[model samples]
Target: MRQDTLWVHREFRQLWAGQTVSQFGTYVGQTVLPLLAATSLGPRPSRWGS
Candidate 1:
């Protein structure tokens, strides 16, 4: 008897691989964008109103 599994299908494997890579890129962007924004901006003002 042949084993049945989603991994056995070529299209599912391709889709799974693509999704994995997309998710990783999303995580990396979410982490890095904020750090970049904070570093690029100037320090906070000492007082709200002078």
Candidate 2:
């Protein structure tokens, strides 16, 4: 029982690590693209839709 639980725990940790990395990359892209758009075009007020 303990070994099975440990295996599941390890699997969750691996999934969490991969998700964290991907989320971080996505956030970086989210920020950079807006900056690039404004810089090339002009300083424009921004609004985010929910």
Candidate 3:
């Protein structure tokens, strides 16, 4: 079978599912961290340097 056809395999499906979940978590963390930092520290540039 060709490499493109390998997605039908069970292992590939599971790997794809896990990778999807992990990527989603990473995206959520990426979005949330900046918001958390903004809220917790306020929107001042001076506070960031020190």
Candidate 4:
């Protein structure tokens, strides 16, 4: 397999920046999703003793 050396090239900075922004948005979504799931679970769903 060939490794993409785009990381060493200055021209790829825009691509990297866009990827970084997208990844950060995904990270925020993942953090909030667990809380959303907890809220939607039914009355006796205290599995972790919360």
Clashes of each: 0, 0, 0, 0
Tens digits of per-residue lDDT for model 4, 1-37: 2357766676687888999999998987998787778
lDDT of 3 by residue, 1-50 (tens): 56679676989889999999999999889998888898998866674585
Q: On a 0 to 1 TM-score scale, where does candidate 2 land against the true structure?
A: 0.48
Off by over 4 Å in 4: 1-11, 33-50
TM-score of each: 0.61, 0.48, 0.53, 0.43
Tens digits of per-residue lDDT for model 1, 1-50: 24598888889889999999999999879998888888998578868668
Off by over 4 Å in 2: 1-8, 36-50
Minimal lDDT window, size 10, model 2? 1-10
Candidate 3: lDDT of 49? Answer: 86
Best by TM-score: 1
* CA displacement after TM-score superposition, residue 45 of candidate 1 (Å): 7.9
| Arranged by TM-score, best first | 1, 3, 2, 4
RMSD of 2: 8.4
Is candidate 1 or 3 superior in lDDT?
Answer: 1
Angstrom error at residue 16, model 3: 0.6
CA error at residue 23 for candidate 4, angstroms? 0.5
Candidate 1, residue 1: CA error in Å?
Answer: 12
Distance (Å) between predicted and true CA of 14, model 2? 0.5
